[model samples]
Target: MSITFEINRGDLAKAITIALKFAGKERELPMLCGINLSIIKGQLTITGTDRFRLGLVRIRPIPETADGATNPDLDGPGSNIGVLPRATATRLLRVIGGPLDGRSPNVELTSSGRELTVADGETRLTVTLVDEKFPDVVGILLDEMERPIDLDLWGVNTALFAAFKDAAWRKGDHATVRLSTASRPAVVRIGDHFIGCLMPVQIAKRGSTASDWKEFLTSEPERPTRTTKRASRAAK
Candidate 1:
């Protein structure tokens, strides 16, 4: 069967933007440099990950027809997974004009084997899908995320937190990260539809943080045992 689904043009633009965050850099992994697009049981999902960070967005399709009918174009079973090149995603977002475009039309995405066609009105983008098997996002984003993080310090690459940058929803939406332990990857969640994971650095000296993650919060924060006033007085 063919893979054809209807999604709001604006929403698709945002999804592409969010997915691009986790995409691999050029030459890092040729296959992973694109957004992993998958349709499971007719539900579409967009994913990007470079091992260090992972981002996933599920684009809820526009509701079916008023009379209730499935997409006629998807009558036969075919490949439900495809990879959209990162360059294609960015260009498409430009074509879509972000999430707040005045014309929020329905975008049709049709994929057959390694070919994908994205069409909205007279604008059409045809590209060859990346030939690669994407990491199992479903398996990665699983129960490990549910584990609550109980620790005084959970050190992760701050860069990983920026996964939410220019996210489809907003530039910086509050995210809740749960890191069970340094050995495991931390769950980074932003809102409902968007979720990801950030792995903590190995703990060398501390057996928790691989690097020397100094606690800047220290140094007499509240009572201030060593105050600037004291330093000035001693200087005199």
Candidate 2:
């Protein structure tokens, strides 16, 4: 069955976020690498994972009436809305971000011979899915242990990105950012490697309220208590 689905900015953003995180770099099984989109129980679930970090997003669709129902199938608005592999979804999102008729921003999905075609206006991307089964990703997400620390999201994100960018110039595959609570420090690792450290930045203020000023600093490598002169000189 052929159907049309309207894609808004929110949906596009969510799709892109999941796709970027899960798209496979290896060329073995290409189809298992795409984001799977399924509509159920009034919620659209987008899932993507590289067997390490699985990203899932549940989005509510815009209010629209389908032809087959008495009240309305608000949950699954379109028929046969199959999965779009990661590569296809990424390209589709890029096209959607470009110049388009805002009033009629629609993505057409057509499945033929094990391939799915994602089209936005004149641009189209086709992706083939491998027959291999997708692993049970949802269960893993559900089983994650609760984090102990309460994070300052805005502060942490800003500090973390800044720390990563600063560490880019360092010579090595390993780079990390570490943040500490009053009691302990948080560490950031890149690709099974430790790179750098980050400290929480506190803002200072005057008047009736008291405050303190703090900033995240990039430091030299964590040195051994007893280090060779060559290593010490290189760090300096």
Candidate 3:
């Protein structure tokens, strides 16, 4: 079946911006330097991942229709996945303008095997799909995780985001944000829609408290105050 669909440029751009966090950077794996766009169950899913982190956004497009049925032009069965160069995709989305534009731009995507064409009005962008298989980003994301701390999306994005950066500075790189019952400091966890593990900037050393030191100091019996007979004899 032919793979072609038109999506609201503004909506597509918003989704891309959300997923761009996972897009890989230069000097990284070429396959990771692209965004994976796929159609599954009538939803267009865009995913970007640098292996360490993943970002995904799903959009259900409904073209203007007289009847309240799904847009046949954008709806189809089965799954079709394609990788688009991140740079090209980003540029294309940016050109589409925001949702508040005087005229809503429509971006058309048509796929032929390894080539996917993106067209917006008169402008068009064609990007080659990467051959390398993308790692299971979803699996990594949904893998067995401690129950996440539920918080408002805005709070996490704003307050928690700044806190994470500050912690990274004090704790150094690769600090882990451990989520566990034993963790005294509150660890923020959101719903399934958004999950993030930030490396902790600083972690208190376990068993380093003054009370712990006092317990250790008093736990052991005092070393025998009496000197050994052999030492005493030597001294004599």
TM-score of each: 0.75, 0.48, 0.58
Q: 66 in model 3: Cα distance from truth in Å?
A: 10
lDDT for each residue of candidate 2 in 1-236, tens digit (9 for 90 to 100): 43334444445554456345544455576545776655545555555555433445555544542332233343555322445666567766666566556534545445454566666566677776445555554443323322355433313336334434322223564544333332233344444211222333443331222121132244455756666987789889
* Candidate 3 Cα outliers beyond 4 Å, as residue runs: 63-70, 73-80, 98-104, 145-204, 207-236
Pairs that collide, model 2? 31-130, 34-85, 34-86, 175-195, 176-195, 176-196, 178-197, 178-198, 179-186, 180-185
Give lDDT tens digits, candidate 1, residues 30-59: 778989887643456788988888888876
Residue 6, candidate 1: alpha-carbon lDDT: 69
Off by over 4 Å in 1: 65-79, 98-104, 146-152, 168-173, 207-236
Per-candidate Cα lDDT values, in order, are 0.72, 0.47, 0.58
Which residue pairs clash in candidate 3?
A: 149-189, 167-201, 171-201, 175-199, 175-200, 176-200
Task: Say what the RMSD of model 3 is.
Answer: 11.9
Highest lDDT against the true fold, candidate? 1
What digit string (tens of lDDT, one per residue) describes model 3 on residues 1-236? 45766777766776676566657776468778878877755778877766545555677665652234345554546464667778877776666655545543667777778887777666677777767677665555444254465421111234334433322212344433434323222332332222344322332464454455566667866786666986798789
Model 2: residue 190 alpha-carbon error in angstroms: 22
Candidate 2 vs candidate 3: the lDDT winner is 3
Of candidate 3, the 10-residue stretch with the lowest lDDT total is 151-160
